[model samples]
Target: MAYTVGEMARRLGVPASTIRYYDKEGLLPFVGRSSGGIRVFTEKDFEWLRIIECLKKTGMSLKDIREYIELAMQGDETIARRLALFRKQRTVLETRMAELQQTMDTLDYKCWFYETAAAHGSTEGISDLPDEALPEALRPVRERLRAAAEAETEEV
Candidate 1:
């Protein structure tokens, strides 16, 4: 079934302007134009939009995504190249995920630390607590924070 740009945008949970911008950027080349100049999207266009959204969320730049789409348009002969591109992007995404996980772990540790402090009247006795009182993973982070504080005090 053919869908107008607004209908497609509503179905996809994106703004109509986003769909129009992607169409202008040639990202939705599979979508056809009506005789009256309205964008007419097929089910295939929805599938293409899903791929575009995934790539965008994975931090792929517009130019690179456009190149990937061009490769796709070149037919089965470009299958190897497309596979290679996806593999490279997968590696990038894995690295990013790892970094984000590490950041989240640190944030979780900090949250626990602050909550402990808040439980007491003040933060005065936090450092005096034993490492066993905190999560095992947070030991090194706390040590680093303590060393930095000591160094700052010494410098002053």
Candidate 2:
């Protein structure tokens, strides 16, 4: 069944203005108009919106997204291009995830370090604690952070 722009926005969990903006930006080329010029959406349109949302979440700019959508509208001949775009996006996400994981690991080590210091009532000897004294999971994180700090100091 068809849906009004408001209904589509509600179903997609976005504001109607966002849908209107997408249309205005040429991202919703497949959307139709009612007799009164109101935007009309269908189930197929939801699939397009979902793709747009996915790409947006992947840090795709509006211009890039519009290009992707245009390529998609061109059908089978653009399959290879689309696949390349997706693969590039996947690589970008993987790199970002790895960086975020490293950051999280560093934060975990900091939390443990501070907790240990608090327990001992001072940080005087915390830095000198042996790796064996750290939780097994955090030992590597601490080592990596220490190495990074040392590298920075050497660079200075």
Candidate 3:
């Protein structure tokens, strides 16, 4: 079934301008337009938008996404290239996920630190506390920070 741009955007939970920007950026080559110059969307277009959103949220740039879409439009013979692009993106995303996990771990430790300090009515001597009191998952973050501090002391 055909849909207008606004209807499609509302259904997809993105701003209409985002859809227009994708069209302008040539990332929506499969999207059609009406005789009156309005965007004409279909169920297929919705699927395309979802794929575009996935690539975008996973940190793929507009240029690379356009390249992937161009390859996709070239039919079945370009399957390998598309697969390679997705595989490369997957690796990049995995690295980013690892980094984000480390960040979350650090934040998790900070939250516990503040909570423990609040419970004690002061943050004093908390750093001298043992790792046995910490969540096991946070021990690595603690070790990493301690290593960094030692490295800095050595540099000085």
List all candidate RMSDs to the true structure: 2.8, 1.6, 1.4
Residue-by-residue lDDT tens digits, candidate 2, 1-156? 999989999988999999999999999999998999988899999999989988888887798889889999999999999888888888888898899999998898889889999999998899899989999999988888889999999999
Q: How close to the true structure is residue 114 of candidate 2, measured as C-alpha lDDT?
A: 94
lDDT, candidate 3, 53-115, per-residue tens: 999999999999999999999999999999999999999999999999988988998899899
Taking the candidates one at a time, how many backbone clashes does each contain? 0, 0, 0
The candidate maximizing TM-score is: 3
Clashing pairs in 3: none
Candidate 1: give the clashing pairs: none
lDDT of 2 at 1: 96
What are the runs in model 2 whose C-alpha is more than 4 Å off?
A: none
TM of each candidate vs. truth? 0.87, 0.90, 0.93
Q: Which lDDT values do the candidates have, in the order given?
A: 0.86, 0.91, 0.92
Query: How big is the positional error of residue 113 in model 1, measured in Å on the Cα after superposition?
Result: 0.6
Best of the two (2, 3) by lDDT: 3
Residue 131 error, candidate 1, Å = 1.4
